[model samples]
Target: MNTGSETQMGIIPPLFCIKCGLEHRLPILIMTAITEQAIQDCMTQIRQKQEPHHSLEIQKYAQLRLMDFAPLLGEWGIDDPKNTPKAKPLPNVAQAFQAAELSAEQKSKLLNYLQQAAKQGSTTAMLYLAYAYAVGKFIAQNPTKAVECARIALKHQDYRAARLLGEMLAFAPALASDVLQNDVQIAAQNWVKTHPKLAQNAEQIPQLITQYLHNPIVAKFVAKQKLQQAKTMGSPIADQRIRGLSMIGVLSSSQPARQYQSIENWLENQLAAAHMPIESDDDMMILPEHMPLMVQEDDDVPVWHKAAIVGGFLLSGAMITLLIIRFLVK
Candidate 1:
């Protein structure tokens, strides 16, 4: 009933079309099926092999397996099987970055490959090039170039690129004043709406924008607004902490006196809460002697104050009166 050749040249013979009852030269279909099957087989073999060297061999074999479909894909006018319009490749930039720790040379080579592919109009490649440039991976740092590449990728409906580009435009200095910022924001919002899972990462984009691009004034306002929203919505604390720290760092760097006062006030309040007397006008509380012994006290003081008491005890003969009062309250 079936007379198709079953050789191992990695080719699947044409099959009869059920609708027409006639054989169709669907080489692309057959090629995809065969290639996928071969890839799976190779992966299975790699997984089953116990030897590390054999596993490496299997990996190499798997990498090259796609080459077998080149001729068939060529006949169907598909030059890049992995990056064909119908078969957009997966994002590999993150994986490449993770590998950067192990091999700088390999990372460079991969980035070069991505750049080349991007220049050839591969959306996925463009996205990766933007990511690589944004992070300065194996290349000179160029946020402007990264944003440009991302825009091009976004034009091709590359949502990942759109998201990253949106983040960059929102925060990166290169596109700070450009109209592309709004475009990027809208695109990113649309993407998150479409892919609900992306919403989690979406919240961080605004912070990233503030960190990388916004002026000090704008940064402070955005950070304050985000912190307020975070407090009310009970958003992820880690995210809020990150944004808060960055904002505080910027504020401290730009406004030293004001920042110092804020810190001092916070410290004073904390010390008062612990019933510790303000020791220094500038530094707040004094360290006590015998820190280990102070910490060994089972009291209801905040952990930080307890640690401070222990540190104070270790440092000098600072009056233990405040510490005693804190314990009394407990």
Candidate 2:
């Protein structure tokens, strides 16, 4: 019997453990389980007729739906949910934030609630605070404080903070979907493989990533790299955003396929931008023209395969030209 909590996130029984070498079934089973869990959560929310906070609850399950998917992470149809931790139910104060505006006192109470929850072992609360601080939700924008909150989450193994931490350490920050949670982490791993001496300890990763953030010239290239990645992934919305973003990295290599972290935060920002009556604000706004569109980032294509496509088109064009010339001579 799958209780709600069991369905929330259950440990793999020792029998199905990969350590015992049930490698083949492990990924398929986990993937099926994830799909089932997301569907169940959606259906439950729908049945309850929870209109006031339906979107919030659904978004939580969507994020929760993808966690610790080591074997199936890269293969799943959506963005890689690289260790995105599960979210607890939103407390009433947090839920009240769905409104167009809140009093300063209300915001304070919300912050306190999240802080208390976090202190009581809620990693998701830590994630919310990390985002809230970074984006200046209730608190002022403070990158350092955001980093501290996320690092604590990461240290506690709530992998969801990995993306926000990567953003703070990016060549430069872009919209939520541009960079990935695992970008810096994975890069650190590759770097460690090559220069074990420089990063003998994992803690050295922040310093190494920080070095890249300070280079103006390199920042443009990295920006371009991420934009190309978004374009490759087929995000037309990402296209409009390019107007003010860095275009210097035109020559830089594209990134691997990725999934978005912090789905709820992104959705919340979009709603505020599109619906908020007041114009003056701090959060990045997507104008009417920048509305969401059908995306086909061709998630299946490997980076090398995408590169090979250029050569394939050139060869085909050359062959067609030769055939036309042969017909003219004939």
Candidate 3:
């Protein structure tokens, strides 16, 4: 299915090692150390001809390591020891999505390139494909295909996919109930798998997941002013998001997700989320916006009941006025 944006090749199933776990907060030095070790391990496997066999959720740590060196990966850092990339991956995921071309042939190069990169485990690449199919941009409208992409990306451990699927659960056309249900089930499983490390672990995570937590790229990630802002908000989802950003890598950290999210607005959202409350503790008895919009039959009172309540208030007022007058006269 290669169409020339990249070299002729089968678009592998773009997988991510997205984290479904809680958090991986670490200082710069520690993070640097972790990244160095992860690179060694990943390269070791690459050189040994062994495939990454960790669970999709566990691969998130690797995802960060790969992204830490994306510049190199894009260049000759980790090419096929046998053949180099034809032309330093075109248009990245950003430039490709921004083009105004409407013809499929014109877009084939961009689409094929992204597909190839995604198949190679590029988070942005997978994300781009999810949005392309979901919205039918240069592709057919296929919510099922969109769901499949987002779902696999979710298992790879990105929150944007979860967020996209959640939105689709309410808005995407024609998705079967099971597809939506499975989205939830997968998310829950990922959350649980990493629950113990949600906010209170680092040394405990198995090496498979932590091998790359140390890296200059990761230090840049944790040190991002925006990333710090996300952590300060202190919501569970925020915690997952910070981890998501780390899993996504610093290169695309400035990029977008869930259809590019106004340019990764999901990640950029941390800046905007600064004003948001960690949780709404207001006891003002507000109903959720998603609740049924129809009138509440039980809450509706009869005309007579409304009239009686009004009349009773008037009568009480008159009685109070009369009593005040009598006291003044005395």
TM-score, every prediction = 0.29, 0.32, 0.33
Clashes of each: 11, 6, 14
Pitting candidate 1 against candidate 2, the one with the higher lDDT is 2
Residue pairs clashing, model 2: 79-259, 80-259, 163-181, 221-249, 233-297, 234-297
Worst 10 residues of 3 by lDDT: 1-10
Model 1: CA > 4 A from native? 1-87, 90-94, 102-105, 171-175, 178-330
Q: After superposition, how far is residue 36 of candidate 2 from its true place, in Å?
A: 47
lDDT per residue (tens digit) for residues 152-244 in model 1: 765664434433433343232223423134433444344434444323333343443323233334433333333343344332242444354
Cα RMSD (angstroms) for every candidate in the order listed:
25.5, 24.2, 20.6
Q: Per-residue lDDT for 1-330 in model 3, tens only?
A: 111122111221112223633332222221112233443565466447587453322222233222232222232222232222221233445555566554667688877877888787664566567666655567753444666886666565544444444434322112322233233224433543544333233233222122222222322432343334423432134445446645665223553223222212222232223323344456654434322245656768889999999999999999999999999999
For candidate 1, the lDDT comes to 0.41
Best by TM-score: 3
Candidate 1 vs. true structure, TM-score: 0.29
The local lDDT score (0 to 100) that residue 221 gets in candidate 1 is 32
Residue-level lDDT tens digits of model 2 in 1-330: 011332223212112123332221121112112233554665465456543232322332332222222221121113333333333445454456445567788878888988998898776677677656554456654434555787676666543444334323332232111123234434434444554343334343344343333333343444454444444444333344344332443223343222112222232333334444543448674445324355677659798997899899999999999999999999
Instruction: Arrange candidates by lDDT, descending.
Output: 2, 3, 1
Candidate 1 root-mean-square deviation in Å: 25.5
